[model samples]
Target: MKADRIVSVIFILIALVFWSQTFGLQYNCSIFPHLILIFLILSSAIMFAQTFFAKDIKREHLSGKDLKYIIISIAIVFVWIYMLDFLGFIVSSVICLSILTLILDQKRPMPVRTLSSVAIYTLMVLVFWFIFHKFLLVPLPTGYLI
Candidate 1:
């Protein structure tokens, strides 16, 4: 089994675990998390099967630049998760999205990136505030913002 196949299989198994936890425990499926988990499980299984049965397993190579990007992305995600508790959804999300957009945009102008980041973050804030807060009745972390 190639590394790719092994990883895909592992992810598929993990997704199954998540699905079981979501449904078996009777958690809130009103948010569609379980549906997303099912999709992940099915997609991972399909990918695993494809990789396992491929005649010519193209060796997936990770270059130094690719590794750097992966590391940075992971670091950003870590900071985003940690900051969410301290800074709440709005502030932390805006900073995270802005940094992510700046990092991901290769040739886009700074003004465009800035505008895009702000727009995305604003939409996220509205969605969280309206849908999650008002409709779903999910309590957001209050980090001195409100």
Candidate 2:
């Protein structure tokens, strides 16, 4: 499909740009990003190839509800990035995660569900905090409260 080809080309270009940028970074900083970029490029290329070779496609379309959910999820990530410097990583991450969880599982009661979501996300954040700070020796962003 035209859309698939376009997306594949765009991803290839983006991967190339990122690959070029990685060359300017220090070895330690560039290694992981380079690895991920290479993986992305290879996967995109393989997918594009498969698109050409595929016998048939179901041509399933995204529902309006699904599209809205995608937009909301993307918006949450952008807002989380913007809030990171001001609110710090832990707080922003937990808040973003809780919100996404609530959005994803809206069938449950709001009050009880919200609290459970927050608790789950808080535990997740703590685990990440420990891994990043202690094991990886990477510093986490800390706001006034933390």
Which candidate wins on TM-score?
A: 2
Model 2 per-residue lDDT tens digits across residues 1-146:
66777888899999999898887789899989988998989988987898788766677799999999999999999998888788887899999998888787758757886897799889999899999988999987776556
Q: Give lDDT: candidate 1, residue 130.
A: 79
Identify the runs in model 2 with alpha carbons over 4 angstroms from their true place: 21-29, 55-71, 82-87, 110-116
Per-model RMSD to reference: 3.7, 3.2
Q: What does the lDDT come to for candidate 2?
A: 0.86
lDDT of 1 by residue, 11-125 (tens): 8788777766665554554248777777887887787788757786456789998888779988998998888788887778778878877886677657876897689788887
lDDT for each candidate structure: 0.77, 0.86
What TM-score, computed on C-alpha atoms, does each candidate reach?
0.68, 0.70
Give the poorly placed runs of model 1, Cα more than 4 Å off. 1-41, 52-60
Cα-lDDT of candidate 1: 0.77
